[model samples]
Target: MSEDERATAEGMQTCWSDSTPGEIHASFSGHRTLCGKPVIEANPIYASRLGDITCSKCGGIAVFDEGAARTRVREVLDKWIAKGKLTPASATEMGNLAIDVFPGRAFTSRRKGHSWNKISTDFLLASGAATDKDASARFVGELGLAVFEGLQASEYQGKY
Candidate 1:
């Protein structure tokens, strides 16, 4: 391979395990698809192409912190609830707080369930965890921290 190609390949390898800024940005451009289905289609083309903003990896848009918000809020919350550090009522309260804190960004449950909620990244902006390029990175870092704390609390001790 050419020198530049070899260098890029090496860098890509690192990003595969621990993504870099450029890699994340580049990867974000491609839509996630699987089994002839797209997971995350472009918002604009979603309506015409895939009919929705579903993520090919998760089968749905995954909202914000549904499964992999990078922040792992749900996982942390689940752990806290499991360990008795947080109650379902409290978890619901946090979800509501998230909604109240980020009015338009919070995802509200349309169903008749008390556990339904929405996710948004507005907290990242509001908390100054990120401003531009580092927003997602900061959020992911926070998610890692949440997971760490949950583990420390013995909630997701062995589940991970």
Candidate 2:
């Protein structure tokens, strides 16, 4: 089989236990989730569907309780505050970043998929790349794996 075919046959990647945590939301700050290597996100599909989940930014793999999520947020804020990255007032302003989401609320994002137009993933799986059921959609400025995998370096004429 072809390389792309081989990748597609392996199916979407459901395990995020081995991945580095990505951003929780693109709307707010670009803080990292405390997943590190969380297990619940090993099966993102299952995690995202549940409530009272943790805020690991692992999306489908947050395993902590609400209290834990709150604590985690505080910890992150503390670290940032100490580093001068955040102040008490700024932290309080974005207090609900990930601390308050739980117990019927899940901290996850849209599914990861692909598109021919590279604009929507609702149509098909990403060729030569594993689909992440829990990963947030690829944002601008970040490299597009599917687009980059098969192209020549010289082909990057300032656009994908």
Candidate 3:
């Protein structure tokens, strides 16, 4: 891991109930989390992709803090600006690029779910915990997907 990554992980270690998240069920049962989002079942096809329960909005508070992520995004933006690939006036565009790294809900014939593959560094130069360079895009992309899937799991701890 990189120095910055090590520092952030050490600083804000999550308070999960176990080394791995618990509380997944075999089927959807219309249960709702404390935060009111309908608890969803583990997407078996991708369960291997996640690490814990989601809906922590009510299961627990994650604080939604992105201090380190913001710092990195700005750093990437500055580099892009310096390369003349962007401009000082591109603050709005920079913000949009940053936001694009987050996974969004998607629907398939079977169910509605987050698009983990979409959360890559190809379009976004940086996220709250990831970055990209031509030489590191592959590793960064995989890491970004893993981090996002874990976040998805933690965010939905309401129950499967």
Candidate 4:
């Protein structure tokens, strides 16, 4: 038999055996019922990770780095407040919204081992704040540009 066929046969045999050594089996025999009705089934995190549930639609398997996102959001918000563009309360609210909405982690290589927790343009669409999708994207781009400008200005001031 071919290697694939042999492997399939072995797997089938393993499934049929009652006591397979070095194999772990899932047991739901002791599940509790709610008022004589079957309770909803819920899998553990490891089970979900092992299954095909780690896709982007399911939020993926990335670790959340809330600290980094919070810091960046606070920095941007503070700069705006100092510039008189945003009131202190408004800055706080926007910073809270950003922390709540954006993912605190990403699986991109551009982060270089650091967490990619920055807010994305798609967040505007997801949060229903974008009347026009293109405009929202442009707004996010402009926000990024503004942050870069603020960084440059800070660096220029620090040089003196």
Best by TM-score: 4
lDDT of 2: 0.31
List model 1 lDDT by residue over 1-160, tens digit each: 2323222111111111122212211112234322122233222322222112222221112222222232345765576678776688876566444322221122122111212211223434445555545634554445434533322232111110
Encode model 3's per-residue lDDT on 1-160: one tens digit a residue: 2333322111222222222356431112224332334444334333322223343332222222233344445555566567775676784464444334332221110023334355343334443334434524543443344434344343433222
| Candidate 3 overall lDDT versus native | 0.35
Ordered by TM-score, highest first, the candidates read: 4, 3, 2, 1
Instruction: Give a tens-digit lDDT track for model 4, residues 50-74.
Output: 1221222112112223344456667
Each candidate: RMSD to true structure?
Answer: 17.3, 18.0, 13.1, 17.3
CA-lDDT, candidates in order: 0.31, 0.31, 0.35, 0.34
Count of backbone collisions in candidate 3: 8
TM-score of each: 0.24, 0.26, 0.30, 0.38
lDDT of 1 at 158: 15
Which runs of model 3 end up more than 4 angstroms from their true locations? 1-64, 100-160
C-alpha lDDT of residue 60 in model 1: 18
Q: What is the lDDT of candidate 4?
A: 0.34
Model 2 lDDT tens row, 4-114: 321211121234333434423110111222334433343333333222223324332222233333444565557657877667897655545323322112222222223
Whole-structure CA lDDT of model 1: 0.31
Model 4 residue runs over 4 Å out of place are: 1-41, 50-62, 104-160
Error of 2 at 19 (Å): 41
